[model samples]
Target: MVTIQLITVKVTAEPSDAVTEGDTVTLTCSVSDVTESMRLVWINSDGKTVVEKTLKEEKQEQGLLQLIIQNADRDRRNWTCVLFHQNIPKVLIPYYLKINMRARILPDIWIITVSSYLFVKLGFAVGLICCLKRMDRISNNRNPPKATGNKETVQLQTLNSDADLRSSNK
Candidate 1:
């Protein structure tokens, strides 16, 4: 005679809703009647399977899985945990894990951008003022002032060397 037993396992996860960026979500799988053959696993929505090393085994019946995301800039996918029964593989437990990003940083970004632009504009204005000042000095130095039309002349008396010599001999 062949006999079949059906059993359902329960799976639980933390933060039923979405989570923030750079955070970790924990998933727990439990079986009512734990057997040595019970297998618990966590799978991502992307169809990639989690490694055994990352999963922490709480006990024979319950298994704890932690999923840490790199970042949550946008809406993220879901992760589910499935359990394999010892007698039959029909019974399953699933937990959905959703991660959410925080509020948008558009305001901060806008402020920074506007401040930078204003700083650049102020720097250019100062630079133009300095350049104009330098140009004015250069032009003034390049041109020399002209003399007036009216001029003054002076005369000086000269002495003959021969007369001076004769006077000295006398």
Candidate 2:
């Protein structure tokens, strides 16, 4: 008769599950049970092994593997923690990372804020111009323009015209 022992492998992210872009992220893999032939490996989304460790190297009863990523990005979002016993894969734990990029959203808000401010200023200038025009119109209606004339100059012109007409008739 033979009995089998179960092992639990877990992966966790340091700082938080979600991080902002350009932040440093750390992924830790821990196993509940450690054996002499047990190996822990960290794999990327592309099925490439990043780091590997064995219980002999750690000299501990529990297995732990850590991978650090500087400047987290979309390319480093997915990872896998694989535990192997005697060169055979036993457990696989996958972790997904969330990165927030504020650069994509802030510009839209800034453009809208600037546009609204300019619109308000333009509206105020237009209203001021309209009010000034209205006031000028009211003032003009109250005081009409007066015509300017020289009385002597008008009389002389009329006399000359009359003389010229009489001479032509004679």
Candidate 3:
């Protein structure tokens, strides 16, 4: 009587599932058992084989394979680990890589934003000054200054008051 053993395949990412830009990531594919006819394969999201390893008859223990990615970016996000027996797929494991990108502000764009803000403020100030000037003109036109007699007549009235004060003192 022959008994068949069930095989299990698993894929794991080293460091963590989330990483920053330009980081290195390692993917490990482990099988519960290794056989002479078993093959381990790593493929990308596009179904392209990245790496493959075939178990030799000499090693009958568990199978382990690793794929290293250097400078990981958003483009290298999806991957799959597959196990094959006699060129037929037996197991498949999928992995997704999350990359955190830093926000960047361009120098030219920053300058333009600041310039636009200052320009708007200046325009508002100029408009306010012009409005105030116009209101002042309108107010002056509505209420003209009261005229206090002519200069020469005011001087003559002051002289007469001085002469009357001297006579009253006498």
Candidate 4:
């Protein structure tokens, strides 16, 4: 009877941030449940082998996968991290790396759309408040003055007689 154990490998990137042009990114390939030593094979998108390292006589217990990308080689590409046992096929996990130069800008149409929506909502609220205040003032009218029927005419006659007496004395 033959017993073959399959090892699981996971790929993880440091910082886990969005990469732009002229930037460097490092990816680590880790293997789990290792009874014996293993090997790592890294391949780029152009079907080219980038790295191959053996951890049989290394001082570190865990395998170290180090990738150094220069400033000019930070463009859009795909990278694959593979772990292979001695006699079995390798297990592969692929990652797509994208690099862009410019940040996505908000469209002018979207800004106009949001601004118009806010204006309509705020205008309606202010108009409703003003109308309610005016209605409240009219409803609370309490002081009603009497109408001027003949009081003005009597006051004017008294004023004329006083003026004539003053002129005669002078």
Best by TM-score: 3
lDDT of 1 by residue, 11-119 (tens): 6556556677656555655455343455566666675666322222344344444555455434445656665444344444455556555667899899999999999
* Over 4 Å off, model 2: 1-4, 57-60, 104-170
The lDDT values for all models are 0.57, 0.86, 0.87, 0.71
Candidate 3 lDDT tens digits, 1-170: 99998778888888866888888999999988675668899999889999999886567878889999999888888999998889999889899988888456587789999999999999999999999999999999999986587898787677678978668768
**lDDT by residue for model 2 over 1-170, one digit each (tens)?**
89887767888899876898899999999987564568899999999999999866345477889999999998889999998888999889889989887476788989999999999999999999999999999999999985459788777677678978668768
Candidate 3 regions with alpha-carbon error over 4 angstroms: 1-4, 103-170
Could you tell me the lDDT of residue 80 within candidate 1? 60
Model 4 spans > 4 angstroms off: 1-6, 57-60, 72-76, 102-170
Order of all candidates by lDDT, from best down to worst?
A: 3, 2, 4, 1
- Model 4 agreement with the true structure over 1-170: per-residue lDDT tens digits: 99976656788765466667667777777775556667777788886779877767344356767665655244435888877778454688897666656443567678888999999999999999999999888877864554567888777666677978667668
Please provide the root mean square deviation of candidate 4 (C-alpha atoms, Å).
14.6
Candidate 4: give the clashing pairs: none
What's the lDDT of the predicted structure labeled candidate 2? 0.86
Worst 10 residues of 2 by lDDT: 54-63
TM-score of every model versus the real structure: 0.45, 0.57, 0.60, 0.49
Model 2 reaches what TM-score against the true structure?
0.57
